[model samples]
Target chain A: MNGTARHRILRGCRALALAASMLGAPALACTDAPRGTGDLGLIVERAAGRLQLVETTGLTALGAIDGLGDLSHASLVYSRDARYAFVFGRDGGLTKVDLLCRRIEARVLQAGNSIGGAISQDGRLVAVANYAPGGVKVFSSDTLELLADIPAEYEPGKRAKVVGLEDATDGRFVFSLFEAGEIWVADVREPRAPRITRLRNIGAQPYDALVTPDGRWYIAGLFGEDGLALLDLWEPEKGVRRILDGYGRGQEPLPVYKMPHLEGWAIAGRHAWLPAIGRHEVLVVDADTWQEVARIPVAGQPVFVMARPDGRQVWVNFALPHNDVVQVIDTHTRALVETLHPGKAVLHLEFTPRGEAVWISARDDDKVVVYDTATLAPRATLPADKPSGIFFTSRAGRIGL
Target chain B: MPARHLELRHLVEHDCGSCHGMTLAGGLGPPLTPSALEGKPLEYIEAMILRGRPGSAMPAWDAMLSEDDARWIARYLKAGTRK
Candidate 1:
């Protein structure tokens, strides 16, 4: 708020829209001041398939929405009134964006290598978890249109690749197939006659999933073995439930370099904290006895253990020479309280929709370093470019972001 | 182009573009284009970048790359870095 105090509030909203259009009154055509995209956010410019509209209350960078095609592995969602923003990418595009009109109000491509997306439980659908001709499409979130395709064959013609796309609670969605270790659950509540619910084997190569934040537990994450499958969405006939099974049992795991993102798990109180696919740990389960209550050791392989929205600290991050560090723990002394380094390649890390501050991107130091969740310090750095995923519009009302 | 080959072309554009595809055109690792290594063999793409891909999640960068940084990231991913 400097530059002469934001140029005196944009010169007092252009002098109250030039004295209310010289006294005939017809200003604010839509908005210019008093806006409220609830402190917006976007940031995934992965090598310039752009999008950097931020605002966590002005840790500034409010606009830069390029064509957004193959964003290296982009991922987005928000619009339960967070004023639109769908994104997805990895060349399968699917855009939508309109975060207070910063552009891209609809773009499609739809599939041919994709992975990531979800926004329904009634936000009028927006699925999208594909991987070059694999499955799940369901659109129409205010007109990205294509309402439901659903292919992930998982056997017949062998399709598979659709991992952990969540959105539970009636409008259903759930996901995960990764070359068919199965875990479907569609039911888009008739978003084109949906009703699926598969679930088979549920192991090997699950490679990413998550849905608990009260949208009941979905939890995939099995990169071809050793732990984590858990479905339950309030007992779907008690089917898939492998939880921490043989966690690196005979050891020899470490060699992952970026994959752990079970929807950035890390709850804190009844304990959750996941991330250990190839060690450098952080496990600690028992979020109501899914068991295995402690592993913790972190600094590398754990790409994001998150939880700082008042669950009292967790925040991890690493993969690739410990991707320029950022540890923190202390969910009531689960240990390691503060490591930081925060730059060069750090990648994602959100929290600040009531967690006071956490941002963190850094993608090889292009910038974005906030912090200050109760004095973990460095509060504010902004300057993203190669940034990979930093979402936010307060993740539009939560539930499995 | 040595600044350590521009830091090995930024570790093959963001550490092998984190499982190839910062336009290498594949995710969960597969397309390291040059027409997908066109009939493979630049020492089998530098032995899958210094001994990796054994039953998959392709790791072994021979402990952070070498052998001329995996033969200069297999000739800058078979001469196609800006893909």
Candidate 2:
């Protein structure tokens, strides 16, 4: 096609109203919207095994793509260019979705069960943290082709489930082994042949973990014990050190209805806001010293303790019985600033790239509510079905999301 | 009774599905599928609903669900009612 013809086609595509195919039909034929995906994102319809491609600026879903299997607790990472999204399904299916085309580009079942995944530093590779066979697998970001597999073998014939896999500054991937109380860093400078470094006895039952914004520290939250394991990627030779040691020192743990995920951890200003497992408090710790500064009691067991881009306010969601509520804390005052109920069973929340707005997903309500960060007022509500995780293409540029 | 029964079902699929997997095949928790519970007795499943396994992440649903609700869920899982 000539330049004018191409321009006409692009204009026509943008002129056409996008019909979000909720009935499993092809989303749109002429889907090249003649725009960038910077403000675009995806919402996981976990029960229906589909994803609704949405744009943050309009606060509306462009279309829906289906056929993803067992998306329970699903997550997605974007390519460096922010064009493609690598969706990691709970059924071990890694689907490469074309955000512009609104279709599945490539997909593969990498394991029996998978928790989540992260894109490599250069965005050339995508890594998945597996639960069934207990390992991490690397795939070509473009083709979804398996390149390497690193099993979390803590003992002979025994493998522990891998969690908290993330990308560091270089071509390295870091993750934690849940059952073995270990952390593994795989250097994928050479994709097929990874250089493995294992740090053992970090802590027991690391339910989930997260890498710091700068990819400096990898922290794993322990479910079997008190405290977390922190490994400095800059100084791996120093081994792992336990931080926030025994915050549960004299308290009895309330029943944790759901496992607290460290993915939502935040380091605002000089302190790190972390969720205390089986406890109703959000632990405020000095990032440099790793000492407990203040424990801010919340509405319930905190699930995600997230920070706004400005680091002025921190938002937290809860586990069952209190999952409907979201509380914000002012880092400076170290006090609860606001409390709001987005809807029933609020599963996940994501702030816009610059933190001007936040989108929260309430599974029971089947809608994602957008809130203005400044006023903390509801901006818009987009309907969905059993929505869980909201991932924006802005994460494409971040180190560890 | 029917409305509450449907709510209980939704609770099982959504609330319990948070950990048990929506299809009940399992994630961090064990599978609640019919095949995964073939040999397990119905009473055991119902009792587990009321009194969750101690020392594990599973919390007793007795606070939210009644004995009748637990029994209904046990049968519902064994039936493997497809969504």
Candidate 3:
């Protein structure tokens, strides 16, 4: 209890802190290796057709993998085990990557052009939505094996580009036909012989579609029509219904430099936050009623309106010239709470599983910025090359990712 | 090209670059390189810029872009200048 004893304790604490830093551990006393692939995620370097592997916990990049083909509009789905990544590239490249080995296990060009893809509920089948020679192709998630090919033919010998492909429960896949104005639900219960149920003339130019988290509803946003077409997967006999009719009826939408990404739909509680195409607003629609409840004006054309996992707040990003800013809205009040300038051309925003932190990808600045969700303060910044989408391993367990 | 030519050009290279590649090699949209635009007319390209092809991913830029801006983008795209 004297000066010499206190000095000794202080020196011992200092020595422990120094050793922890030297061992690349946190200041606290514990011995653990750096994160493994199970704790890792990916950031797409679009132009290079590569992915930067990163450890989600440390906010540090592990390595980069190349030869991914065209990744400009690429999207990925992780295996159920969280040990593999199924990357669907724009050039129709279906690649299965082993996270542990940090290398591609298998790769194949499945189509001429693809927009994105989905994994089945059981994580057994991988489905890709194609734009050219259009259709949806289902592959075995394990080896990228060609399981079944369902060409999206609008008419006999005439094909239509498919978009918004999402896998629902019970091994069912739903997607919209861009040119045919139809929505098809393919029951892949029998993988090779997919039983397709088509609802024709649902709307005009269905740009993109998404399924609710519960996998009950398939909503397609129409480009040629003002309203969105909704299909109740549970009751396909009910057919497609129209919701939010004449959304752009009286107003001329401002020039949209980039199409609003529908994958940005965020469901918080009972309301769904969706980006209003060509508008600087995020539409809050009742998930159950499928009706517009409120419209939250934002700083720019809202591109991605993602909700934190806890469903308390929704984060929105904008399309360029205003892509430098990001805004967070309190879901309870449906009000904009804060806006942060992440960097130049904020392309994508992703929140950690528990909503503890959010990662933002700024393409122009070539940096991935991570921020603490509660404090709204920057935590770490890692250099990247034109990063677009950030995907976490936690997605492996979720449906409709 | 006008006084804000660089800005507009960057817009094509960056903003339009969102769909079209940053280098204008094309992603969702077709490539805008000189070789690809060789047979296409400048007026057609400018029209496509000002009034986007509806029912597709392209959106009209006439609201935010001046005629000069559209023409500059058309010319720049046809010239195949990379960023």
Error of 1 at A363 (Å): 16
- Of 1 and 2, the candidate ahead on DockQ is 2
lDDT of 1: 0.82
Give residue A139's lDDT in candidate 3 (0 to 100): 91
Instruction: Point out where model 3 deviates above 4 Å.
Output: A1-38, B1-38, B54-57, B62-69, B79-83
Best by TM-score: 2
Taking all chains together, the TM-score of candidate 2 against the true structure is 0.93
**TM per candidate:** 0.31, 0.93, 0.87
Question: Where does candidate 1 chain B have its weakest 10-residue lDDT segment?
Answer: B15-24
What is the clash count of model 1?
Answer: 4
Q: Per-residue CA lDDT of candidate 2, range A150-214, in tens?
A: 88888999988888898888899999887788888999999999999989889888888888888
The clash tally of candidate 2 reads: 0
State in Å the error of residue A377, model 2: 1.0
Question: Best lDDT goes to which candidate?
Answer: 2
DockQ of each: 0.19, 0.68, 0.40
Better of 1 and 3 by lDDT: 3
What lDDT does the true structure give each of the candidates? 0.82, 0.88, 0.83
How far out, in Å, is residue A340 in model 2?
0.7
Interface RMSD of each: 6.3, 1.3, 3.2
Writing each residue's lDDT as its tens digit, candidate 3 over A221-284 gives 8877688998988898899999999877788776667767787479899999998876788999
Native-to-model Cα distance after best TM-score fit, residue A134 in candidate 3, in Å: 0.6
